[model samples]
Target: MLFVNSDKIKSKPLPSLSENTFLRYFSFAALYVAQGIPEGLLWYAIPAWLAMNGKSPAEIGSYVAVVGIPWSLKIINAPIMDRFTYLSMGRRRPWVLFGQLGLILSFLSMSLIADPLNNMSALMILGFIVSFFEVSQDIAVDGMAIDILPVDQQARANGLMWGSKTLGISASVAAGSWIMSHYGYFYAIVSFSLVISVIILVPLLLRERPGEKLLPWTNGEASKAAEKIQLHSWKGIFKSLYKVFFLPVSFIMGVAAFSYSFGRGLIDTVLPVFTVQELGWADTDYSQIFATANLISGILGMIIGGFLIDYFGKVRMISIYMSLLILLACAMSFLKSFWQNDIFVTGFIICFYILLTFTNIAIFASAMQLCWKRISITQFTLYMAISNLGLAAGAALLGPLKDLFNWEYVILCYIVFAVVMLVAIRFINFEKHQKRVEDLEIKHPDINIG
Candidate 1:
């Protein structure tokens, strides 16, 4: 059977990812892997390659900071995605497809760069453009996951998603570095785009709910489940988003998210330049080390991180992990002599990644617990946006900080930024926020925010 509207058509529905627990995990993981490939290429390989080629830390740091602009603007994109969509085709699927297509187009555009090193301005612009689409896909997927996954499953699913992303980052960084070194950046991006192209099929084939449209052109209608929560107007969306976002606990989480990443961003920005320039490691050597760290940690994530978060408690786990990281930062800062030892350096990076992964799983899961479903897109994206803004500021600060102080002093500052997260975490009362949302949902039962 076929059905057509005045202007739109949707195919007969397929099974929703929500219908199968396995599908839920697999689909999200697959899409995350897609996210990681390009991310690794842009965030890791390209930057490292530039460093290896003699680019200054200031140049590289500023470039990365600028390219991250789109992610920081997820606050803007969230409302639009939440409010506007062909509901029949699934809420987030449309944006996911759109984002992936834009990513591919922007990726291919890289080939047009005759000389990437010489055209740093163009590189930043195009990278910004790519990040725009990347954030779109990211928010849509996050909202969808919140809507569909059961609470008990969220921690575990997050583990799979992050693990998948790490695997993709490892592969692309390792492979992209090799490709860019032997061939060119053009080949590296083009090859990564092809993998992204393959991943597009995952969302395209998996519907959010049964009886919803599979595609715009096929005969289908919005699932009853979807229509129940779909906000009818922009005003309703914003009103609902504001109602929940201003709650005290939600605001604290945002603060914590921001402060936590600033330290991470500082460390991230310092790594390549520090390793390659100061420590005498080759660019390839650094990338391989990074890839190896991600590979081991990704497996650890898939095997244990999620389960631990679920079993031990999300916030509690995060607190413990934060303490470990602060100690590691102190150790690394004081042991400047160890900086030259390849084994010690590699171990430090890997241990940091491992601890960070455990806490990140918890942190993300905690954030998801606070979302008012009706405004999940905006609220969750805001937390992520705040976190990224911190990361961007940290990255941008690195060059100036390096010029002003010794490496030990620079490393010590991370503890300050990270300690803010510990304090913020101490104040967040998830039950308080959840209870408030519960009360509000009862008061406005018609909105289906629950």
Candidate 2:
């Protein structure tokens, strides 16, 4: 239902790749790899570890929702990142560095805390702080990536971030889980902290190009306005916050994200339980299988997804992939009998894993393409935040549904979601999107299209 007119604005041709270009790409990718470490830890380690700790679905759902709230509520920070700059360190670099430090501290704090479930209230609060800083780092990194990269290489930049991040995620999920299962949580925490500390140090060697035009705060004495703040201004702060709350692209991205996240959240929350309760799989076995899926299959999917986005363009590929995901979800929903049968379960799981790999690739690629290069990261995070919200929503609803219905019936609920998602994907036409971009260039002369 939403149409973006920015695509109509034309910019100069993006530069061709040279030796310098390759160096920049590689360096940025390496930097991304480090940032990716914590992200992977959060995604893979946190969720699975919680499930293993005997957290109920509703409790698990609430925790995820709490963590993701920063992303949804603080999307305003993205635009601020767009408008603001740090004078001394660099535009994005300072924020990235600070965020990285926060990540290490958060992980250490979580690791030191003895019992996640027992100290649920305090742990949840700390988890929220971690998610906030993690998301904040994402905003800066994504905005910087978008601003610095050439238009043609947008997908490549996206690929680097996604591929690297996913690799980190798979490692943490697979390897981290294994280590946690075998060794104590203390050992696992210490080992992870050490690895990430090394990764976070990468930014010391690199830098981002600041915006061409310096703003008032960067050069002018306009910053002294901060000294003028008074208690009465809080009302005005709320009003400004209200106006900044809605961004068009973010709103659309949020809608798509909510749909995607809700569907995904339901599957994630229930799957481990299903594996244990229904399939009778052991932790070690599930860990092995999960790791294998992520290590080999996830890497391949991410690499292929990058190339495919560049070849076919982001919107087209993403729409196709999203549609495919809906199909996959529906198929899984109705295929419950396969899970019950010994002969079919193994093969069905294989198919399901493959489907998940492909679905994630497409979703990521489409999301990258959907957002213009510079804002792609911010938009991506917002989308992710909204999706996480949907996931929480699904988790909250699924518990009651599970209590009232059977496993087969609970999964069948995905059918309704899949159908709805497919319809949403249908509304997105890539060719038209590309044309709209072209038209926007022709019409709008002032806005910087990139």
Angstrom error at residue 395, model 2 = 2.5
What tens digits encode model 1's per-residue C-alpha lDDT throughout 219-298? 77888777777787777787787788888998888889999998889998888888888888998798778767778888
The lDDT of model 2 is 0.59
Q: Cα-based RMSD of the predictions, in order? A: 5.5, 11.0
**Among all candidates shown, the one with the greatest lDDT:** 1
Give lDDT for model 1: 0.85
Candidate 2 residue lDDT tens string, 210-247: 22112224422212211122112333333322322243
After superposition, which runs of candidate 1 have C-alpha atoms over 4 Å from their true positions?
A: 1-14, 46-67, 108-128, 180-189, 269-288, 333-342, 395-410, 445-450
